[model samples]
Target: MSNPSSKPIGLEIDLLETQGGKVPLEYFHKLISQLQKNHSLDHLSASPASAGEFDVVYIILSKGTLYEETETNAYECIIIDGWSCWPAGFAYLLVPPNRRREKANISGGDNGPSDTADIKIALLPIAQTRGFGRFVIRTLLSHAFDALGIRRVTASILCPIQPSHSVAQKKQVGFNTKQLCWIFEKFGFKFEGISRGALMSMSVVEGEEPVWHDVHRMSMLITDYFQEKRSLSLSAMRSFSREFPLKVVQQSPWEIMIQRQEKEKHDVESWSKRPNDASANDACGNDGEASDDETVLGGDEISEK
Candidate 1:
């Protein structure tokens, strides 16, 4: 079976209420079936639509109150669809900024941005990997950084085990294993230090990552070395004349033969003048003759003493 989460597709985020007052029970049943096929939903308490039936019942769930203390709160729900391998699912959750802070450890410190807003995302188990999580994060960042002019925002991943750390790493989001510190370093979150299990951020702002100038400089040096080596090799092979007037005249055939005859005559004279001793005999034993197999200089006939 194809993993629906692996499919590459854009997510469409819309308010849950836009569909109608209550979605048909059949839609919920289809969604539950899809989730059952793709993921483990044993923790959820979904009931059959009717007695002795397997179909799921449709229900409208309230998220959070719009107002604080008096039960007025803004309710946010997500309806995700268009996944090729799985049916659609709905996730409804309350996103009361103040109320959420009271119950959860939302970052609202002096180091944290004062104007930033808190947004919570709830997803059905099957819809977690179908680009829904990324879409929600991008949306939150756009609103915090672009719309509200907020420098940074924070989020709390509610799952007992957050498996999307790799996904966050791909997006360059910074992680702090400390409490209330899921800081997106791309938007100015910084490593202040370690706290509990999360990282503390002293400041948050959008900035470029540090560039490695030394790496580029080293690459240029290597390139220059190769270029210089090539130039030296080429110059060694190229023909060039010296500027000085020193000349080497070629010896004529007669001049070369005369020099050879003089050398042989001197050798014979030295051998004859030697004392009749064993050492002298040994020295002249080989004779002043070039072997027949020896190479003669510029002549076809051997010289006769």
Candidate 2:
């Protein structure tokens, strides 16, 4: 089987340039129109293809440091095509080294400060359902960790106030419940303090809220019960046997050598008690001659009678 990393997945990333020329508004408008028709950007209060809706754009267009690794730094924009179709794809922006400290403290410690080039991912609404969201995420992570020398990257998924949070938890994305109380908190994105039951509110269409509490409780209960069962099974197995499993099954090397030495000693003693081979052979020859002589004499006596 081929390694998954070696496969030619063919994703192209480009840096957006802010100087010398402007992207025609019509291009963005068309892109946004397509996004609105197919996706749920309204929940996040974001318009398709607009810089205003994306955090990555602010870092790229204003900062002028983001660039595609595969392409020359000279090229300002990249056009991605010729792959599986998805509603939403990600745009990556590289954060310069000088600015990373100012941006966010991702993990604690100054242990080997990360290079200034950081990546920020912006999700397009059109790329959401066709598994593009996950694909982009994986691809970006691969690039960041493998190619770009980046230690960290951040992205947000907008979650509905209730049951949708469960999906986020299932996906293992960070969630901040306190951020959920704030009206302006970015959907699926939190500054910090995210945990399994923390809710982050994003706009939701009116309907029956999802029953996440049941799922959460069930997840915990199942985990606890399985752990208890595993512990009991292990204890029972251990108590059922008096000897260590290894000791009961096989002799140690030292014990095997000692047994062999004792067997050799017994054989030597038994051989010493037995008569010598030469003496036994001589006694057999003498006995055979005596028997022959007795047979001949008996035959002569019978004939004389």
Candidate 3:
């Protein structure tokens, strides 16, 4: 709960940095080892810990912010021991090579530029309940939308069929599927659907076999991101400490506000250009739209976890 400014202490590292001799792979190994030892993250899906598994790695530092950029500073970031340069959490994005641009038919017509990517984030137990998650998410989404030109970002969260734990044990575990969904929704992600039997259970019960579990799918479009930015109050923006600079391309609070204003103007123009028939269908909910009952059923998927 500390981090009053909600500013993220982040360091960006390319997995290729190991091969380039910029940073050694052993540092990353230490990070993964410490992350695996944290029992609180058992409920979440395993991320790309190995060098070959992911393209980029964003390391969120602890206590203070990252200032200078040096090999020693980078090594300190990876050496997460919960004391000096503690890693609060990590996040990454997987972008397919030769990805084709696709239209995001959110408003019945061509809204704006659209592309897609997938994201994953995990935080240490000590970092939770603080503003670390918010900072990480804001940075990731900003990178995806602004730098990468990604219009839609998807997240598939693991939802266990039966979590092995008592009431007390449950308290120590990280956010469940429902809590994660709620948190993501707060960040403008919409519940897409659930993939049945998408992942094997990460929990282990003595003498019991691991069971297949579903994955909750959610997404945030560029429009949603704009809306989220517009809804935030100026005071909320000020709460973010600008002292801790992130290692990625992120918009400032004032920049976000300016972009929001521009986007609002663009939206009005786009709305005026939309075809009448598409608008009618949207109003009537006639284009294979989910009924209220079906929507309720989808919402119920997150009720358990």
Residue-pair clashes per candidate: 16, 10, 1
Compose the digit string of candidate 2's lDDT tens values, residues 1-305. 22222322433333224412233344334434544554433223223343321123321111122333564542233233333222133344444443344345555555444443333333443222333333443454455445544544443334334444476564443233222223112111224322343333433456855332110110112233335446656766676564446454788999999999999999999988967467755655664355555676784465642
Compare candidates 1 and 3 on lDDT and give the better one. 3
* The candidate that achieves the highest TM-score relative to the unseen native structure: 3
Q: What does candidate 3's lDDT look like per residue over 1-305, in tens digits? A: 34322564443323335434233556655666666776434445555553133244566556443443443443245333334454555666765332322222123433434356777777767668766777767877887787767668887787644655676554533256678888889888999988888787755576887787778888999999888777675535555555454578888999999999999999999889956555644665646767676687885465664
Candidates 1 and 3: which is better by TM-score? 3
Give candidate 3's TM-score: 0.54
lDDT of each: 0.37, 0.38, 0.63
What lDDT does candidate 3 reach at residue 153? Answer: 89
lDDT of 1 at 62: 22
Backbone clash pairs in model 3 (N, Cα, C under 3 Å; residues 3+ apart or in different chains), count: 1
The number of the candidate with the highest lDDT is 3
Ranking by TM-score: 3, 2, 1
Off by over 4 Å in 1: 1-10, 16-113, 158-305
Collision pairs in model 3: 178-305
Candidate 2 weakest ten by summed lDDT: 213-222
Q: Residue 158, candidate 3: how far off, in angstroms? A: 1.0
